[model samples]
Target: MGVDFSGPEARAALGVVAPFDMELDAELLRWLPDDVDMLMTRTPFVDDVVTVEFAREVADEGVVADGVRSVTAGRAEVVAYACTSGSFVRGRAGQESLLGVMRGAGAGEAVTTSGAIVEALQALGVRRVAVATPYVPTLSHLLDSFLGEYGVSVTGHDGLGLEQRIWEVPYAATAALIRSVDSSEAEAIVVSCTNLPTYDLIAPLEAELGKPIITANQATMWAALRRLGRRPTAPGQALADH
Candidate 1:
């Protein structure tokens, strides 16, 4: 009798996988690691205070953990939240609690775009930052408070006072937001909110501002890679480039 050893070892494993949330029609996949088995789970697309208040309805841990278990066949290397406002609106302890849920649910590593922004800022050696968000002013102020707990200061910031229109804000307007909030004292410019497309604008904007521009998606992907102990040369991103 021959021992054909191929059962468990034969599984087609997708290595260093990262899972991030995507709303309908989002180009989130294009922003992730190409060499890894990247996957998506939908989060509520609306960028409103209601979505942030009713967190469980949108960034629900159960939905994410279940999706992770389903997609990676067992466990994903990292489960990263793609929403900035939703993750940060709850403040610091809240993010830790949010990641706690992901870890308890079976994630190898837990990260949120908001949490990553903190790490990215620290890693880039920036303490005071300028920020621009697409949410209403209330949400923007909440983000400022969130960063304070981490010892990072939002010396300057603004929001578009938007509801569902965050995704619709033009790149020019986003660039304008950066300029509006940015100051010489701010070591970095953080363009908050994941729904906005930012990667294409990162290089040009950073070049223009002469300071690091950390967007929601940029920090999310950067943190996912760092959690995996990776050091990819992600161009135009100070967090990854470091």
Candidate 2:
């Protein structure tokens, strides 16, 4: 498992690398099972930049390569590139390219948060999508551009301008931000960004919003498990419902 800020339940064993500011140990300790062991990798970046260059740089060759190296060194069962926008911005071709690089670095299997989102959407038969992110407007636009390349139409998109600190964003704030979007025309809702904690809220959001809700962390976990041929025993909601 590649935990993001939102944390995960017990029964999952994984490592985490924060591409942004996130308190992983506290969050995970709250929910992680005692039997599961975890390691943390921190990749921090400054907030001042017009192009989101740091976010891109960490995702591009460095973070992915480093993450792959860590996974290989640990001999972990799986490794995932945890940023949704980072992987999607690289597009499908770029995702494959990164996966190849990860394999070369030492991972037996690799998956991206973006690819997981796509798989989750497709599993639920989602075509038209409404998206919300804690990213700035520029990165939000980049995400829209990336999703477009995957043949998923974005019916609407909203960004909270929270940037890298999105992990600290409260769940209520995220739910409220997502609720403000007009997703009636979309087949599903995508809350993009692993750093933002959205896993525990996925079920309630789906029920209230009346559409399948796919979050970055949830999708990434689901995809990585699928790669390991493991079926998540959790209840039906989000991608697990499929």
Candidate 3:
């Protein structure tokens, strides 16, 4: 008797806990190798507004713990909290606490979008960054403060001031925002917000601006895949290709 293998072998699984409004799973998948699997769960949906208060609600400790637990059953190698503001709203200490919560809830390894952004920046030896986000001014400032905690400087910043439907923002508008904030002092451009799509646009924008670009979802997936000793499938992305 004989048997044949018909499909790609599963090498590993990475669990992702996204915000209720996250619509970029396909984008995340594009970065993954065919052998790796992505298991995803979302925090409970709230009102449609995307605000600081909403980020707080989604980042509640209990919510994070439950979300981590939901994905642990799949035996994922790592669990990632995929909302940038939700993980960074409380700053560095809060980001550490989220990792603790995910670990306590059965994740062997844990990462968060904001935390991954910091790791990616450090990996590239980037110290100064330009920031762009779909959030309002207040939330944008929080991201700046979050990066500052890691000794990274936000040399330039701009926001779209959207209260909801951040995912609906097209790439052209995001590209415009990235260009507007880019400055000579910035070593990289950080596109905040996991729900904002930047997967296909990363390499081209990097060429246009002549600097590295780190987007929330890209960083989250990169940090998680790193735990598996694998690089993402992003061909020309500075952080992923690194």
Candidate 1 residue pairs in backbone clash: none
lDDT tens per residue, model 3, 10-74: 46889999988888899989989888889999999888587889999999989989999999887
Best by lDDT: 3
lDDT of all the models against the reference?
0.70, 0.70, 0.91
TM-score of every model? 0.82, 0.82, 0.96
List the candidates ranked by TM-score, beginning with the highest: 3, 1, 2
Model 2 lDDT tens row, 7-60? 455443455544655443453333333444445565556465323565566676
lDDT per residue for candidate 1 within 1-242, as digits (tens), equals: 99987764322122121223334223444544555545555543434343456343565656555655554455355777677876777788878887887777666777887898999998898899988887767667888898889998888878887766466678898888888998899999888877787766788888888989988877877788776665544566566676
Candidate 2 Cα errors over 4 Å, as ranges:
1-17, 24-40, 44-51, 233-236
Top model number, TM-score? 3
lDDT of 3: 0.91
What is the TM-score of candidate 3? 0.96
